[model samples]
Each structure stands twice: as C-alpha cells, then as structure tokens.
Target: MTVHNYKLTVTWSGNRGTGTSGYRDYERSHVISADGKPSIPGSSDPAFRGDATRWNPEELLLASASACHKLWYLHLCADAGIVVTAYEDHAQGTMNGDRFERIVLRPRVTIAAGDRALAMRLHHQAHAQCYIAKSVNFPIDCEPSIE
Candidate 1:
C-alpha cells in the first residue's frame, strides 16, 4: 500500500491590537499555505464574526469533497469512453452547531456523447472512491444530472 502525506501552515493574522484579550477583540482570519502553491485566505463563518470575503473551513470542506468526487468521476468517465464537455457542482453542507450533519453535491454535467445511464452510475462509483468522502464521517450524497 502506498501512503501520501500532506502538510500546510495556518498562520493566524487577526490580532487587532490587544490580541485575544476579549471574545470579540480579534478577527477570525488566517492564511493557509503549502509549498509551491498559492496561499488561501481563511476565516470563520460570518455568523461567528468572521470575514465573509474570505474562505471558511466549512466551505473549504465542502469544496474538497466536491472536487474529489469530480476528479474521480472524470477519470472514470474518461476510461469508460464517455466524453464530458462541461461539469459544475453546487455543493452544500449542513452543520448542526459545530458538527457537519451531511453534504450534498449537485453536479450538472454536459456530455458531447455518452451513455446517460452509465454517466449517472459513475457518480456512485466516484463517491465510493473519493478520498475526502471516505475520510469524512458524514454522509456525502451526489445528485447528478447529465445533459
């Protein structure tokens, strides 16, 4: 078995002036960076006093799951001789307090020519193989429509 390791740095950048002296004293902002990659601006949910302009952990988690599934699905489609033209996913996550209850991925796909039934089936296969979906404890459901 082969294992891959990933690493990144998260530096807090929200010390307003006095630091975390009070609950609302500091901003919930940070930078996420890895070697040879662009840095990501991160913050908490806007409801939690975070900057809505920056990315939040919940959104990032949902993006990761969606991206992983998309990558796997595309690879499977390619190997199966299905020609995919366009793909877009509208993914959503439900969080009850601090824990995520579930994530739903709504992918709209446009194919030049392919088996519609097989393309739909590939979503289940993609979800089963997605690393992020496998790692997460919550359910990740894929609702895919092919055109």
Candidate 2:
C-alpha cells in the first residue's frame, strides 16, 4: 500500500483590535490555503458568531465526503462500462453533540447509456471505496437517483 501526505496552512484572521480580550471580541474567521491552490475563506458556524458567507468546517467535511464519493463513483462507472452523463449531490451531515453522527449523500445521476441497475449498484461500491468515507467514523449513506 502507498501512503500520501498532504499539508495546508490555516491562518487565523479573527483577531479583533482587542485580540481575544473578551469572549465576543474576536471573530471566528480564517484563511485556508495550500501550495498552488486557491485560498478558501473559512469561519465558524453562524451559531458560533461566524460569518455566514464563509465556509465552515462542518460544511467542508460534508463537501469532502461528497466529492470523494463522486470521483470514485465516476471512475467505477467508467470501468464498469456504465456511461454517466451528469451527476450532482446535495449531501448533508448530522452532528450529535460535538461530533458528527452520520452523513447522507443525495446524488442525482443522469445516464446517457448504461444499465440503470448496475449504475445504482455502483453507488454502493463507490461508497465502500471512497477514502473519505472509510476515514470518517460516522456512517455515510448514499441515496442515488438514476435517470
């Protein structure tokens, strides 16, 4: 097996003039950047006094899982001779207390040419093979609609 290493820098941009002198003094904002990649504006959830316009960790986590599964599913579909025309996912994650309990991936797939049953089955295979799904402790469920 081969192991891969990844690195990124997160610079806190939440320092208000007071600089954490009080609980509500600072903002919950930051910048996430990596070499050759565009920086991502990040902030805590709105409930935690974060900017609603910025990306939050919880949302990013869901996106990561959804993206990983989409990539893997496409690859598997190609190898299996299932032709997929388009795909989009509206994935959601549920948090229990301080941790995530589960995530559901709702993928709408458009198939130009392929066996619908085989295409649906590939979702299960894709979930099983997704690295993010394997890494996370929570359960990831896929509900795919094939067209």
Candidate 3:
C-alpha cells in the first residue's frame, strides 16, 4: 500500500505585546499556510474569546469533511457517467462542550438528467470513499438532494 504525506505550517500572529500574561492577554489569531496556496487566517471560535472575522478550527474541520466528500462524489459521478452540473454543501457540525458530536453534510447537487437511483447511490459510495470522513471519529452523515 502507498501512503501519502501532507504538510502545512501554522504560525501564531496574535501577540498583544505582553503575550499570554492573563486569560485575555493574547489573541487567538494565527495563519495556516502551505506552499503554492493562499494563507488562511485562523482563530478560536468567537464564543471562546476569538475574533469573529477569522476562520475557526471547528469550521475548518467541517469544511475539510465537506470538501473531501464533494471531491469524492464528483469523481464517482464522472466515472459512473452521471453528469454533474452544480454542487454545494451547507455542512453543519455539532459540538458537545470540547468534543465534536457529529457533522451533517447537506449537499444540493444538480446533474444532467439520468438514472436518479444511481446518482443517489453515489452519495453512499462517496461517503465510504472520503478520506477525511474515515479519519474523523465523529459521525459524518450526508443528506443529499439531487436535482
């Protein structure tokens, strides 16, 4: 079996001079950067004394799952002769205190008229094939609406 490796750098950018002197001293802001890609401004969730404007870790987790599933679904559709037009997912992740409970991927997909049953089945296949979904301990359920 072949294993692939990925790497990225996360740099803290929120030192407010004093630097973690107290509970509210330092900012929760940081930058997630990788080669040949744009940097992502990251922070803790606003509920945890973070910047509301930055992308939080919780949201990033949900996004990773959603994006992974979408890519896999599209690949399966193409291979199965299901012509896909539009695809979007409004993914929601639920957290219980500090731990994640579940993630729901509500995907709205538009396809070129074909076997609807097969199109629906591709969602299950995509779920099974998603690397991120398989890695996460929390449940990732796909609720897809094909049009």
The models' CA-based lDDT, in order, is 0.96, 0.95, 0.95
Give candidate 1 misplaced runs (Cα > 4 Å): none
Give the count of colliding residue pairs in each prediction.
0, 0, 0
Per-candidate TM equals 0.97, 0.97, 0.97
Name the better of 1 and 2 by lDDT.
1
- What are the per-residue Cα lDDT tens digits for candidate 2 across 1-147? 999999999999999888999989999999999999999999999988999999999999999999999999999999988889899999999998899999999999998888999999999999999999999888999999999
Query: For residues 100-134, what per-residue lDDT tens digits would candidate 3 score against the true structure?
Result: 99999999999996678899999999999999999
Q: In model 1, which residue pairs have backbone atoms overlapping below 3 Å?
A: none
**How well does candidate 1 score on lDDT at residue 121?**
98
TM-score quality measure for candidate 3: 0.97
Model 1 agreement with the true structure over 25-73: per-residue lDDT tens digits = 9999999999999999999999999999999999999999999999999
Query: For model 1, where is the 10-residue window of minimal lDDT?
Result: 110-119
